[model samples]
Target: MKIKDRVIELLSDKYCGLLPIKSIHEEDTIIDIGFDSLRFMEFVVLIEEEYHIEFPDDLLDIQSTTTVREVIERLEKEV
Candidate 1:
């Protein structure tokens, strides 16, 4: 699946549909989409497992304001 689709799926599952995936925009930050620190960390873990890549430690410093598009861009670079 495309990275964006997979991200939506993972988040939708994790949040139990609390997140309205269809309403999310590429530029929207995780916090803007209702993800707190714990939820974001869980999402990161899912991304790591799905891509079979360990994110750099510096990634943990990513701001909550980081956009979905930015995250996808970073993941694509890793791939």
Candidate 2:
């Protein structure tokens, strides 16, 4: 499965509402999602489990500048 698909699956399971996947896939940040702290934590859990790698602390500091592609890039780097 693709990265987007895995993300969508986790979102569905976690009921994370609608992620701005299209915008993120286009190299745009997911700023429109308005994901709060709780949701962002869930996203981090999903990323960790899906990629099987602990995310660096810096990812938590990236605010509206982080995109799905960028996240995937980070995961690939660790994997």
RMSD to the true structure for each prediction, in A, is 2.2, 3.1
Q: Write the per-residue lDDT of candidate 2 for residues 1-79, one digit (tens) a residue.
A: 8765666455443456365434334364645455555676877877787678787788776577777567667755676
Error of 2 at 16 (Å): 2.6
Please provide, for model 1 over 1-79, each residue's C-alpha lDDT reduced to its tens digit, 9 standing for 90 to 100.
8877776777664453246677777888867877777767877787787789997565666586788788777777886
Q: Where in model 2 is the C-alpha error above 4 Å?
A: 8-15, 20-24
Query: Residue 13: error of model 1 in Å?
Result: 4.6
